[model samples]
Target: MVAGTSTALGWLLVLLFSAVAWYLSGQRRAGNKRGKLPPGPTPLPLVGNLFHLDPREMHRSLEKLSKTYGPVYTIHLGSLPCVVLCGYQAVKEALVDQGDDFSDRGAFPVFYRFTQGNGIAFSNGEKWKVLRRFALHTLKNFGMGRSSLEPRIQEEAQCLAQEFQGKKGVPFNPIDLVCRAVSNVICVLVFGKRYDYEDADFLLLLDHFNENFRIMSSRWGELYNIFPRLMDFVPGPHHRIFHNFEKLRQFITEHVRRHQKHLDRNNPQDYIDHFLLRMEQEKQDPQSYFHMDTLVMSTHNLFFGGTETTSTTLRYGFLILMKYPEVAARVQQEIDRVVGPGRPPCLADRKAMPYTDAVVYEIQRFISILPMGLPRAVIRDTPFRGFLLPKGTNVIPLLSSVLSDPTRFKDPASFNPANFLDKEDAFQGNDAFVPFAPGKRICLGASLARMEIFLFLTTILQQFTLQPLVPPAEIDLTPLCTGLGNVPRPYEFRVLPR
Candidate 1:
């Protein structure tokens, strides 16, 4: 009874504290409203638009708000007023046409707490630019987005297929297998080596990443991002996010230390070696972003970016293929016709296999991973669509809306490869297809992801036939969760050798 009373008192104190903080934040917000903001629904005191948003389907909820309040409008997410851009036209105008104006990384509390405004993903201003440029330059030198990396991906794809072959067409979850395979591709580039599939430590780290992604996509994570201050006092799975981040950080730090011991200033092997060299060169400059913390955060950003979305897309794509067997049959036919069974699928053959190419594009479009495309902040107070967006205003370019715009797609609800195919059955592209987003802040690993997805999916299909446990018509394509990324529903499937 005494413990219960203490807990009640604690809760009361927290509520009172939160109310005061909200009031102060609102007062600061009023002073910061530099110009006439876009029109939207009025928010209530303290809660803001929490009641209006369904945390589970945040992107969809925001998209629905567009119907009532035009394409571009403002919505309050717990004291923070965020400008949401819905559909292709609005998103394109802001992210593409007015790219510089909306180029800054927005405030994302879930990531901000861990990153602390350090990494390539969360950092803003000069730090973001320098780190991004250096990472891109180093990646290019190491063959990112180039044909030179194809062999590495192909080798990993074969290992993945061999692992599936060991399954003997039996029911087994391919989550770890696919994740290991995908992560290893980036692993080779970032760490300069890949761990054995049976390595317990590696598997545990992968599990942490998987679990973190799942939790961050859950409603708990959404709540954390919205009311970070209040949620810090609460307890839930969301706490695991920081725990996993620490584990990931420890792993990266160990790798960085190991690389430091074997430092090669002239003969750089991978990303870490290159970064270490840069750190040495810039050690004299006090303001250099090339430091230990940034290195770890940047590595984490690249490693996570390279691993999660591509693997999830492949997993979801496999489910879609099983759900629609005819699509699988047609892809395999194209594979056999173009590449033959002599070798694995390469980037070159993508042009010849238009159907397969279209399928890959359609899969990315259908899944719409990273639906909200990591929020953006306006760099300065700027005129936008007759409204003035103040400096540091948060904006959400709803990539989900762009991918599913009715004007851009014939039937946005259904998954169809024809969305990327022309009347002549040739591979085509759409302006609305901003899966990696548009403009300067696009995902750094976009090209690597494209190559990985194409190679991994085609290689798997060439080697085995995907068999679902349930009827094709009954296979569900809905995501298990919708935050962070569109997490595919987990299932076990059999893979038969072709």
Candidate 2:
């Protein structure tokens, strides 16, 4: 019986080796068919270059690899080979110069599993184009970036400030407050109304969103993206991501259903109303992208996109201000001079408040949120820098490298507003300051996000000064984790009346 068991184990070992050999030979043949590609560390049979990467610090790991392989190189995530574009020039050349060719969304299994190629973010081709255009139009119609939306944001900011005042100078983590305030802005557009800050259901939904964003930015999420099929059978926090998504999905679907019942094609109230109208218009068209599934996914895209990054930025920005009191003071001085606490900061005040504008821009650059940016893919076979990328090859544009490139910024390591200030102390924009990324597929809510960040942050400062629990020098700006997002370390602070 022992001899038989040994014989069976020997046969299993032989099969494993045979599979590896077959995969390698197949890779060789494919390499011959595809033209020259950038060289990088050799990958193993099935795992590819997974070992070479530090899953926790994906952006830094990719940057380190760029040191040896130059700006553009190829690294495999499992069997999938993604071309990495590091530094500003390479990234700009590919994402900007050859925008159309590399305009497609790459395979992001984690999000795709939930979205199923239905939303604007994960979907590709004409479906993406249609949904994106429709969503943008709907958001604009609902006053997304225009002056009309200012009242909604200003009202929300005032609510946020009053909420802080209610804290009575007690120390507290501002995550939920900031998230709710930021989310309410999108809530107005998507759901047609905002929620009370203490609303249990709304708070629960925010909790799930926060948890999902944290987990999706964890090592488990990175591993899932690389080896999704394998990670499915394995257990970890990554599973929570999908579970949280289902909760959000159910919430959005219920809202969608409510809108469907009160559908008025003439007077569409919000995003859901607009989408239901579109679905009715396209009901007869079999090829139409408008459907119940797409509406839910698209609404999820706008709601999630609107909330997460902007709130995270505010949370991180507040921490930075606490760390550098002098910078915060300077911003407050600018605010006092311009807005003078008479009203909330407006977009029109931006040009006059150069220092505050510089500070805001600097904060975005310093954190480098979405460090690796979203993955991209080539729509068709394209040649980049004498190397041909196949029709569907995945691409990673390292935005962190661009933001922190020595060639681009004088001192990329430190957090200095001077990086964005010119000789005359005027606000200067940099080509590399693309926190929203640049291309046809740039974030749909980029303009609105800019407005919210500026208004909400300035409003908070206008009402109170952020007092850190620890000394300014002792405050650490290091992120808690870095994956899809650079999550700032958690801390509690008191807001003294300004």
Candidate 3:
């Protein structure tokens, strides 16, 4: 009996050693396959390249890595392999030529928790297609690109002017004013009305959304993506972020219910009304994706996308104008020559005021708010630039690299409007200038955003000359805190009346 027991123990030991050998052999084979990928910094086990990433200065860090690893490189964030496309050529190749293969957005854990694969931005497959199509159609019906919406934007712009006038030329942060104006534009489109700057509900919603944006771009947020199960148990900023998201969801849900009660099938006025009509139209279809949940999420996306992005861009526009007084003067001169103070500038005037138009384009290029344009996934095994991108691989298109490509722009680092102005003195559009991203998933609000930037900047420049309170050197152009967008540090300037 003792001899038999010893033999059995010996057999168990042999089996355990064989299993260990097989696992190590599999890891070695995976390592060999990874070796053929585009070059990048060597990663440590488990953590991969997590220690190398700095949440605050991620853009700068990525830019430096691009210098060493060529324009296309791969890095592992924990077990997930992320392929970074840098420079204009690399980004254009992945985002434009092969757009269909690379258009699927990678589902981040935190975003997935909030969005639940319902909204346009974070969704994929048939749901994303349906939501995106419905959103575009609904926005068009609500006068997005038509003349009907021009008056609404003008009204918001005028209200913004009045708010700034109330400042009495004192040095004050203009961020709030810009935020209110931009948010109201979406409010008019989504809810068919505008809110006063002091409205309690509006202010609360803004605070909640802003907090959510800030937290999503923080270190804690990154950690959550790495270790979701562990992070969920710990009380920290991620928990606060989830709380803010819940507040926003509740706010949107209330608005959606109100819209449903008052929706007019015959006269669908705003996005909510139009969506309600569509929901009824498709209610009988079992495969239909249009419903109250999606409507609420879509409205949430429109408000979040339309408000934060445009406002941040305009805020930076003013900061740039203040820093470069000469540029501001030239833009005002162009506006005066083409669009006098007697008339409010329209999108049509963009063609006439070439210099002013160039300045606006340059601001979008320089700011590059969405540095790492939303991550995309490979839906199927695909070949991207001679590299075998397996299905489910996450790809990141680096917008900062494209915006600041020295080969494309004359002086990419500096705020130079001449980059967009040709010898003929016309606003020259460059193929490399891709602020709204590219191809299929480009910003849905691109047309509206362009109009707002031109009209608002021209109107303000026509009325007042933006000047720094102190010397230009005193102005801080460095980004404040990296959020869902790049935000300028809070500063005050004197808006000298023209």
Instruction: Identify the leading candidate in terms of lDDT.
Output: 1
Candidate 3 global TM-score: 0.90
| TM agreement with the true structure for every prediction | 0.95, 0.94, 0.90
Colliding residue pairs in candidate 3: none
Say which prediction, candidate 1 or candidate 3, comes out ahead on TM-score.
1
In Å, residue 383's CA in model 1 sits off its true spot by 0.6
Candidate 2 residue runs with Cα over 4 Å from true position:
1-32
Looking at model 1, residue 233 earns an lDDT score of 68
Task: Report the error of model 1 at residue 34, Å.
Answer: 1.9
Give candidate 3's whole-model lDDT.
0.80
Residues 33-125, candidate 1: write the lDDT tens digits: 467788888986665787688889999999999999999998888778889999999999999999999999987889999899997988999
lDDT ranking from best to worst? 1, 2, 3
lDDT scores of the candidates, listed in order = 0.90, 0.89, 0.80
| Candidate 1 off by > 4 Å | 1-31
Decreasing TM-score order of the candidates = 1, 2, 3
The digit string of per-residue lDDT tens for model 2 on 247-308 reads 99999999998998888778889999988888888899999999988988998988899999
Instruction: Look at candidate 1 and give me any clashing residue pairs.
Output: none
In the range 247-330, model 3's lDDT, one tens digit per residue, is 888988888888878887788778888888888989999888888778878888899999888988999999988888888888
RMSD of 3: 9.0
Whole-structure CA lDDT of model 1: 0.90
